[model samples]
Target chain A: MDPLILASEECDIAREVVCVPANVLDLFEFNSVPIFIGLGAVIIALVMYFALRKPKLVPGKFQASVESLISLVSDSIARDVIGPEGVKYVPYLLSLFFFIWVGNLMELVPGINFPFTSRMAIPLTLALLTWVIFVVEGIRKQGLHFFLDLIWPPGVPVALKPLVGLIEFVSTLIVRPFSLTVRLFANLVAGHVMLALLLGSAGFFLLGVLGGDISVLRGSIGAAWFVVGVAIFMFEVLVGFLQAYIFTLLSAVYIESSLHPQH
Target chain B: MIADVLILAEEATESSGIDLLIPTVPELVGGVLAFAVVFFVMWKFAWPQMQQLLDNRQKAIAGQIQEAEAIKAEAQSLLDDYRQQVAGAKSEANQIVEAARSQADTVKADLIAKAQTEAQGIVGKAREDASSEKARAMTEARQEVANLSIDLAEKVVGNSLDRAAQKSLVDNYLASLEGA
Candidate 1:
């Protein structure tokens, strides 16, 4: 069978097991991790709903834990990116943060390992939402001037003005989504591939032609893979949270830039 | 390749479902649909609530921190007040003690001076009395001596006068009486 067929077969297996969103949804072959992602969000919402049935002066352990995480995201992304305005947007950013983080983390769970973010659809959709928020708010606040400000942020030299406008426009509109999709997709794929490769090295080598042994190569592979796997696991964990954060951060910055039209 | 995947998704159904043979990754249509679902669901259900919760939460935490600061300031003020009061009390106590000491010293000195003056007056009056008594005694002694001398003379004359001298003394006495 062709490798594409094999890959398709693997995807089919992934579909059966993973929450692979049907291609009917998009041009990208992303698993409908959002189904799970959204469901997870709803579930988180439900959890928070029940947890916060009555908002208390002294939060319970679970409430405190959830609130702490929300606060952390608020501090890290909302404050850092949006500044004072960021304070208000923390809720949106926090939801984005936790949802993405949980989506990425789900992959670590046994038998449920493929993160939806590996699919371009997940992050792309999220980034697109950010774009919409910024755009809507931008137009609402600055009228048609929001886009103009993107082109020339008022203080630029008249000579360098057109070039800077073009650059800023392309960066904000075109590069924004591309980079968002790429950042999340690439990290997730890389992390998954790394894990798979680490896990399969022994099986692959041992099953090779005329190979009836798990040799020193296999041992080294296992040991090295284990160590690297552990380190990568931690890094990927950070990346999972960080990419979501970056997505939100960039979104906030982009919105601020568009809204303020200043440096 | 992406186009082919789009066709398959379009063809997808509960009965026909996802075909396992196709391998193409859906990029654009999937992007649109996923974007739609995510944005819609989030905006309608999750985002607003989350945003409200977060906003309220942010305000609350900030309020908490601000309240904590206020409590700290109030506590600090109370502490400062108590400290001032203690300091004032100490100074006041010291002032009272100092005033008492100075007042006692003045009183003691006045009493000592008054006592000295009165003692001197008593001594001077006692000396004067002693001198007057001495003068009186001397004068009295002188007069008693004179009287005794006179009395002795009289006795001696009377002794000499006897009977003979009685007529002469009588004459003389008679002369003295006549002359008197």
Candidate 2:
């Protein structure tokens, strides 16, 4: 059945499409998001394992590539953003980056066409993880004073302290995770939707043309849609990488903020 | 576009509230569990190994640099030692040459003095011999002349006087010749 045509015919069918299983076992059995999450983890594990299997003083191509990636996260993301103490968090940061990147790439994969991070739940989970770490790091590093620092940033004018304090409290505690989750989830969802629409429209129109429908216009539009879809597909690849970078970079920034609060 | 997507999504889910933003329990749990496992494995195995390898590489490079510096210093020391030895040898050679030249000069002066003394000795001996030979020749000539005079007198005077007298006359004439 043509899902787009069916969706149009009975827009009510959208409910059935969206009504996912709620039970824990049933959700796992039915949901591809968790399954893909597990798959992404496996891929990361295998790649890391194989990359580090035969460690050499002089690295080969695969090892060099893997080491360069590790250096990117460790040096560029963790150390550069979060400072020297960030070395301790390199593993978690590295895992987060690869996991999200692989999850984002799933939108382009054939058998699995849905990006796992398009679901709010997964991004929420990851963002919450980051939120927990940064908040815990803040508490650990600054003790109880972290909250005071968060609520009342130094150097604010006495007249505006209360206003600034309120804003800081919301921004630091509430908005950070929300923004992280929505940023990753919304971007992937939007990219996924655009791709699906363009490709689905292309399929529909091209099938009409191939089936000898009596419109030269449909064929041209289908060709155009396909071309644009391909372009968007390439763009999503970049976006996948960019979103993962942004997410991890933000996490680092948050961690740094926690570690070194303003005086 | 976002509004349209949201509307479509809302229609699909048939929920109009923030329920769309909410995650199912299973996915959140699964994602967390998966990431946790990955983080654990990475922390346990991969990153520490990589860190070790990186540290070892840095140490190896540092060791090599130190070794190279040591070798360079040793080479420089050896070169300096050789230069010092060469300088000593050159000075020693000059001294030896100077001593040889001085010794040669001394030997030349001694030889010249000895040759002069030998020449003087030969000249003195030659003078002594010439004087002796002259005396002998004069004596022989005088004796011969005396004998001839005696014979001539015997022939003329026919043994007029004694031979002893003639000998005495010859001796007296020779003595007179010596006195003149």
Model 1 chain B poorest 10 in a row by lDDT: B15-24
Q: Give the TM-score of candidate 2.
A: 0.76
Index of the highest-DockQ prediction: 2
Q: List the residue pairs that clash in candidate 2.
A: none
Give per-residue CA lDDT, model 2, range A1-263, as digits (tens).
Answer: 32334443332211222211121112112355688889988988998889887788889999999899889999999999988999998998998888899899998997676788887888898899899998898999999999988888887888998899999989989999999999998899778767766665566567666777526664666677788889999999999999999999999999899999887
Give me the displacement of residue A139 in model 1, in angstroms. 1.0
> Mind giving the per-residue lDDT tens digits that candidate 2 earns over B118-148?
9999999999999999999988988888888
Candidate 1 lDDT tens digits, A50-164:
5555655556797677667766666766676667777666556755676677767766766555576666556766778788888888898889988787777778999999899
* C-alpha local distance difference test of each model: 0.62, 0.81
DockQ of each: 0.06, 0.27
TM-score, every prediction:
0.54, 0.76
Question: What is candidate 2's DockQ?
Answer: 0.27
Per-prediction interface RMSD in Å: 10.5, 6.2
lDDT of 1 by residue, B89-133 (tens): 999999999999999999999999999999999999999999999
